[model samples]
Target: MSTPTGFMQYQRELPADRDPIERIKDWNEFHKHLSDEQLRTQGARCMDCGTPYCHTGMELAGSASGCPVNNLIPEWNNLIYRGLWREALDRLHKTNNFPEFTGRVCPAPCEGSCTVGLIGDPVTIKTIEHAIIERGFEEGWVVAQPPKVRTGKKVAVVGSGPAGLAAAAQLNKAGHKVTVYERADRLGGLLTYGIPTMKLEKNVVDRRVNLMREEGIEFVTNTEIGKDISRDELLKEFDAVIMCGGATKAREVEIEGRELNGIHLAMDYLNGTIKSYLDSNLEDGNYISAKDKDVIVIGGGDTGTDCVATALRHGCKSVTQFGTVGKAPLERDIINNPWPQFPNVYTLDYAQEEAKALYGEDPRAFSVLTKKFVGDANGNLKELHTVQIERTVDPETGRRIYKDIPGTEKVWPADLVFIAVGFEGPEKTLIDSFGLEQDRRTNVKAAYGKYKTNVDKVFAAGDMRRGQSLVVWAINEGREAAREVDKYLMGSSMLP
Candidate 1:
């Protein structure tokens, strides 16, 4: 630890983001940064609490309680506090392959369980992590250092998202010839399309990917596993296969008029906008437009907030987000949402914050259920019908129950609608082609610690196995699966 009384001396602080209203005009990253002294001050907030849980990497109440990659958070925080940027970067890189990714998009669960959070605000762990990696990059300390020896083993990682990238990085580090396959035109999966540019600039993704490429990882983009590359071919070519294809089967609602023209899936909308922006800077008419339209986003969480923000940038006339769950409490409920669990509280996410700045109120509408989509004469979207419901927990069963209130139905003027309900599991085409077994949730049935599938050398990890989850958890799974794959290839695995 840097100082015994550091936590008491420094209050938690983070860099202010670019002005929301101004940022919506373009697709540049909105994140600003703190000065070196300010960052060191924030790092000092990490106290010398006994048995630190910031790096515990466990689940509590079905939520991530700490850093999933088991980042040496405290060690690096003290290093940052001491103005040892290079040492801090080393500590960070020892665990996380891409700190830049987590530093930007990850909803840091480590801070929720920080010991200082029990009484006061938690340390700015996420921002500090971001700053350290950026500083390392700026100082020319971060560079590709390929493994000195090749294991003569080839590993194929499906998907280029957090998990796939992590697995590929680890396997490559273990001296395995790693090849990552992505169905998209670009290498990065969710990082490229699923997220908006305002949150994570694509250039940041390209920088890390280029570094990995320099490290000898082969990235095959726009190639589907089952279609372009067959299962038998992959088995014949690669020594082992790690499935990190992510849960792509979107969860959809069955309702009337759902097939209307303007109704679209959340991913489809996000993918199109980001891809188009990247390809032609939105000069070409390849993406969906929300301009001058009444937009309604169904569902909550980051995806829904992204829809709201995307719509705002599209200059939509108005935007609204509907959620099936009740609003979170303003403060953490110490009884149900106690220490160590990710805090379930009401706070405007970056996207929602931008939406609020433009719309004059929070764009989210909670505890509301979609009834049906009302279409016009030409079968285009007209309005959305919804019913307000009372969400309550059954005392004995501890199950959630939703009961619609009488006469609470309302019609929202929505020319366009985006469904962000969530995902069911990994898409079936590749799984079925590979003849992989699936669990009840439609997720690949691979053991958690042991990622091996029915096939001898074929493994599974990330959202494909765990269902829709945080990017950090996906990174954890990817790293672990790589270890298992490495062990299978060689007599033993030295990977952590």
Candidate 2:
């Protein structure tokens, strides 16, 4: 593998980030890259276990525990440790099409399963990944390569999110004519609008979108498949169709006064804010402005953290996040989460740090459940009532039990309330139109290896098929689904 002696001697190192107080003033990425030497040293910390579970990509405890894309983690780590930047990048891109995206946002399950992490800190797998991709981009190694010959077959991708983009890119590389349709005016569905610019810069996404366009992939915007164009029209116009529509429907809290004007869905607020920022610097009201408002977000997930950060940028008076789950232990809790699995220990993300810097304390309230929203006479939300909940595991049933404790009710003043619980599934219109079955989780029903639906010549992938998930998972699904579609279209195919 890599230099064996170097690995046992060096220590792991992670990239440093900007100060939270300064970072919240503007919408920019807070992460700072490690130097080339630092990155190589970090890679040298990989022990390169004989049984590398980091890239296994297998189901553990009924859920994926390692890299879902089955990235060649050990191979890349070795390459990086040897200072072979190009080779490491080549191996990384073999499975993942967009390492830049995942490097910044992916939770990095590969590190969680790293054998080196069983006893100490995991090898800096995420750091080496970022360095390799960033180097590729800087050295002009990444360029659009259109297929040499045309297959004369056409495919239509129904969304412009990560999954749709991945499938379209792969299908086009296989010499098939591909077109991506997006309901939004811009491409990069959630990446362009749903996510804030601070986490992932729009220019980064736009650069890739431009490259795809150069590769002769057609992108149609403001086109709703069912509403603007009929489903039959798509079936007739294309040889095959791939549905990558993301799960847009947000999970909402149905409580008293939820209909208040100031109350909004997390996606709505986030999407609006990003879109507005894109249009003439927010002058057109393209995004929801949280300026000068007392925002009380009702959820402690990534979405809620994003809301808190966005409100701080808008100069909000105050912000708080209500979470139903108990706070995680400060240190690794191997008894429950276990080693070689994702650690559920408490960590400070960018938004949480910014909130702490501004308010002098983190705004998270663990085990607090929102009971109801209180609205003013103008139909605007003014406050939120919440109660502390005790969570217990049932011994016999093996299920989680929650009980509201007495005398723990509290109220917080809130002008803007965002429900950031999560997402349910993709929209029902297209699934119903295709007569496709849905899983118990409301995702499009199809066997893991079999992407075919009830109808002929129809396939699904990403959030539409697997429900709300990480972007890396969407990329994996898209690649697998493209292989299935290519096989269906040409009997035998040559796509990797």
Candidate 3:
């Protein structure tokens, strides 16, 4: 530890955010950066605990305990404390291929499991991570490093999301020719389209993609494996196929008046908005606008929060987010969810903060389930009918079950409804075309650490294999899967 007593000397601090009212007026990132000295001091706060569960990356209590990538958190923290910015960046990239993305979007499960968090605030790990990478970029230290020797092997990675990009980066480093195929017009699958500009700007994604291209990884957009390109042709052309196609099949909410106008799936709405923003800055009317409309967002996860923020930015009259589960405790109840596990505590994300600033109150309505959508004669959604639910533990399974409360039906006027429930699993088109086996949840049946599918020379990773998960986990899957793919192709792997 660079500073033995540093943990006692400093408290956790993050960079200030742009004012919510002003930031919501535009679609740019709201975070401001801390000075080098301030960031160094924050880094010094890492306690370097004996056990150091912050980077264990284990699954505890049915959730993530720490960083799945098992980042060298203590090493980088010490490096930053000693003002070794470049060294810290090198250490960061050793674990994560795209620290910028994870730093910007990851919920920081590492912080949740921090030993210091059991007593007080955790170290600002995410902010320190962002500083290290951004500094590397500013100093021109981050650049393309193409492999020196060619292995004469080729790999086709389907999907250009975080998982695919990470796999391509790793496989290319192993001297294999890697080509990423994306069905969308852009290279980044979820990073560029599914996420809004304010959360993760498209230019950040572009910067990484351009660097990957320089590193000799090829990207082919507007290419669908099963639809545009034949599976047989793909299998014949590439020596190995890695299915990183994300779990994109959205979980649908089936109810009466579901086909009504002014109602859409969350991904469709977000994708269209980002595309329109990229094309002509949303002036061309290529997206569904929430302007002057009462918006109702179904689901209360990050996706639902994004929808709330996007609708607010579109000048919606009002917005409300519904969650099927009850609100989490404001503070962690140690008796229920013990320390060293990811805390099930309430958090005010950027979107919720923006909503509070704009609407005079938080927009979330917890423990609510939509019963049906009521529409006008013209098929335009007009109201949402919902009922409150009470949660109970099932004695046999010990799983929480929701029971609708009687006589609690309520209706709210709504002009636009976005279903941000979640995703089920990967799309079946490519999986079926490749004749791959599927798990009970419809994810590609590939064992963890092995990553091999039923078909020889075919591999699966990320959300396709693990079901919907965090970006950090996706990157971990990609890196691990790449190692397996490398071993399968070259008789052994040098990848960690």
lDDT of 1 by residue, 419-474 (tens): 99999999989999999999999999999989999977899999999999988998
Query: Would you list the C-alpha lDDT of every candidate in the order shown?
Result: 0.91, 0.85, 0.93
For residues 145-257, could you state the per-residue lDDT of candidate 2 as single tens digits?
Answer: 89999999999999999999999989998889999999999999888877789889988888888889999999999998888888889899999898999888899788999
Q: What residue pairs clash in candidate 2, if any at all?
A: 272-287, 273-287, 276-286, 276-287
Q: Give the poorly placed runs of model 1, Cα more than 4 Å off.
A: 393-398
RMSD to the native, candidate 1? 1.3
Q: What is the model-wide C-alpha lDDT for candidate 3?
A: 0.93
List the candidates' TM-scores in order. 0.98, 0.96, 0.98
Candidate 3, residue 270: how far the Cα is off, in Å: 0.5
lDDT of 3 by residue, 7-48 (tens): 788888889999999998999999999998998898888988
Residue runs of model 3 more than 4 Å from their true location after superposition: 394-399
> Candidate 2: which stretches are off by over 4 Å?
59-63, 393-398
